[model samples]
Target: MKNSIAILLCVSIFFIQCKEADSNSKKPTVYTVGDSTVKNGQGDGAAGLWGWGDFINQFLDTTKVKVKNHALGGTSSRTYIQKGLWKPVLDSLKKGDYVLLQFGHNDDGPINDDFRARGTIKGIGSESEEIDNMLTGKHEVVHTYGWYLSKIIKEAKSKGAIPVVMSPIPRNKWEGKKVPRNNDSYGLWAKQVAAREHVTFIDLNEQMAQKMETLGEDKIYGNLFYKKDHTHTSAKGAVLAASIITQELKKTNNSLKDFVLENPTIILPKKTNIYLIGDSTVANNGIPEAVGWGVELHKYLDTTRVNIINKARGGRSSRTFYNEKLWQAVYDTLQKGDFVLMQFGHNDGGHIDQPKYRGSIQGISDSTMVVTKNDSIKETVHTYGWYMATFINQAKEKGAIPIVFSHIPRNEWKGNSVERADKTYGLWAKQIAQKNNAAFIDLNDSISVAYEKIGAKKIKQFFPKDHTHTNADGASFNASIVVICLKADKSLGLRDLVLSQKEIDRLSQIALNTSIENKK
Candidate 1:
């Protein structure tokens, strides 16, 4: 007994010393800059759409360094710095910290007097002077896009931060059924600036487009597009994008290169308590071999960080999600920074004459009323707004960041068009998010965009022939969509968990291997 105790104590001390030594080693800090495409939640509602920025987190070891994403919606090179978002970061920059800058989408906005005008001409001294007088609303000077980008590089370098430039990701627009190049546009411009500045450049646009070509349009839709939008990637697509960035980074930064894993990072631990609370799309008891988005979420998250305790019972509205103590059960176990994603509204559509499941009657209302059930208790079905808001509000009350998803889409995708939301659950959810200032994900719009690009025939592979519920591929595909939305939402702080290409491949391979192994 004495010998055993002494041996264990010695081993423990050795590990403790090693951990201390490891902690002392300096890790590099990564700061991000970009427009809405790289920002969080810009493409939330699209089916599988997500910004690559969100998935970048997974590639880094959090123990070594912190990754801060300051990207926001509607920001272009000209606006990001002018809005003062870049100043605080520049001021806080420390030696050896890295700044990864991406822009282009919003930078393409026309140079109008409107707030949405983010576009400026490309090149080093390119300038189009526009002046709006006072009362013309926020009179400001708009610089050329390249000039603004150059400013960011100059400022970041002054602060002793290493600047790495990446081109904006390519949109889904195709020339003769093939994705085009940024050679004549933003991609070329970004490269030109990087060359002039002596900064490292990652051609994300070229890399993504090339990979998409290799994957082929068919595979690209399966791996990338959330619902229909070709420009953005699904969770799977983001993972793939992150992987490409990692591989490119590895060619130079050897330290980060080895951290790549062979799995997509969704490995689950047995008895992990994951609680799924959503509408029919995320609930249990959907069609056989057909599960909700939540059902497949466990496949991407690390099991060590989770417990697969699914509480997603079917046929429950957002009101019922909490009334039945579903959120309460998950809330009880939540630790600091734990996530509770609330998706609903497949069944909360306009109900004819039925008080229950009806949208907010009397104009976006959330007034609470009482009803007595046969059980002799007063029950209430809160307005769709009230139900969703309450769930998010309560989750936040429990110290959890409530991620609000604006309902997964129905299978009404055609070529470049989706069945418009038509003032049902999708609209109501958006209102709930805005009212509470909650982190809302627009899955509906993102998916609709995707539907338009992929068209009706290709979408059939993802949404199922029955037009409801997804297959394993479909479920995994939809789950990727959710990840993409969360990644872009910036509010979710999920950028640190994004996976690299090798890591994604590893994760995908592992998932495939695990499935194969299970089959055997």
Candidate 2:
């Protein structure tokens, strides 16, 4: 009898271990259902657009739970069910699985229209509308948006699956410094349905709107949406939206929340300082009519993320800038990751040994000259390339990134084309950047492109009285040009730190208008 009991106990232990293994191997799935903002274009990021559902999986522990996104573009809560999209998802539901439902973007359209009938009645009441389908030519009974959402919740619960109802994300439209929310409409109805069914409710619209308010209107247009598209999101925007959803999930403390990864804190490096070293075109002299591009550059930058210090002074060439102790002041403050933009050529045309000598020998050669100035101060001047190389090497030694910029164009037009310095300073700057392993921006060429596009008639408005130093409008335009170049160069890593395209355009237009008015 003792031997038989021992065998039975061993068999029982083996069975318990097998059961535990099977339980551990089984993986739960979290399904999502919503409109375009949740999952746009099959969640493939087509046309440079993305949806939040495509990114939410990154925040979850996929090893423990799987994510399935069934959101379709141009879908509403009513059509999602009417087109039988919910049936397959419902059939796949199992006990311990989770279903997240978000809708209401297309629920406000006309119910029975000949052109894409996809709307449902509003509210969560027991209301139904009988209509003859124009496209299908069949008599159908339509329910309210709330009724459809409640159906999804109840069906999920009936199948022993957990239901999570999220109000739709708010549109990009803003009203009086705030992004308008769906609180009175779909948001309220979603909350009511979740309460009635005892399911988890997430006020995504309000939460996202609050975040948008914090980001402000300029950032909302710049950082969130694609070009001229306020409905859909860019890749960065999708990530931000998904992060908000992740936070709400944790707050809800649902069973599925256990499968989510803890939100990782992003530790950014100390703010880098940007120093502008150039001629009068890059200085700040408190002259409204003679504003420099460097003075206006800070407007396009996210100041909270970086600092801009315009150390440029008038009448300073690449040679004179270092000789006059200006470069030393900037170099003294250089920290790791700091940036320096150097542009000089306007005053570098004088004779090397004259009293007003400022020009450095052109090209990347190591040519040097001894100049005796009016103050009888003997100085050893190096070639333009040598000076640039010195600055680049010194900055790199201090763990700073050095960038070279060609001189800005002087509003000179040749047969409807803006003349650029591509043959002179531009070429030398590019050569120096390549030789020293530094970044280079051809500001002359870049601004010339904009000028050609704007035509000489409109472009001349930026240059108020002179061809060299620009007015406020012209300075802002040049600053925007520099920003555009910085954004294109991935090595600079400034694209993610600049303002949005919309914000830039808005500011540029304002500057243009203001300058034109002042000139008139």
Name the best candidate (by TM-score): 2
TM-score for all models, in order of appearance: 0.49, 0.60
Question: At residue 118, what lDDT does model 2 achieve?
Answer: 86
Residue 375 C-alpha lDDT in model 2? 90
Give lDDT tens digits, candidate 1, residues 314-432.
66766666677876777788765566777777666544135554333322486765665556666665677877777778767867666677777777654457775647777777788
State, as a TM-score between 0 and 1, how close model 1 is to the true structure: 0.49
Model 2: ten consecutive residues of lowest lDDT: 263-272
Candidate 1, residue 354: Cα displacement in angstroms equals 35
Q: Candidate 1: minimum summed lDDT over ten consecutive residues — where?
A: 266-275
Candidate 2 accuracy as TM-score: 0.60
Q: Candidate 2 deviates by what RMSD?
A: 8.9
Candidate 1 regions exceeding 4 Å error are 1-26, 42-48, 126-128, 133-136, 253-520
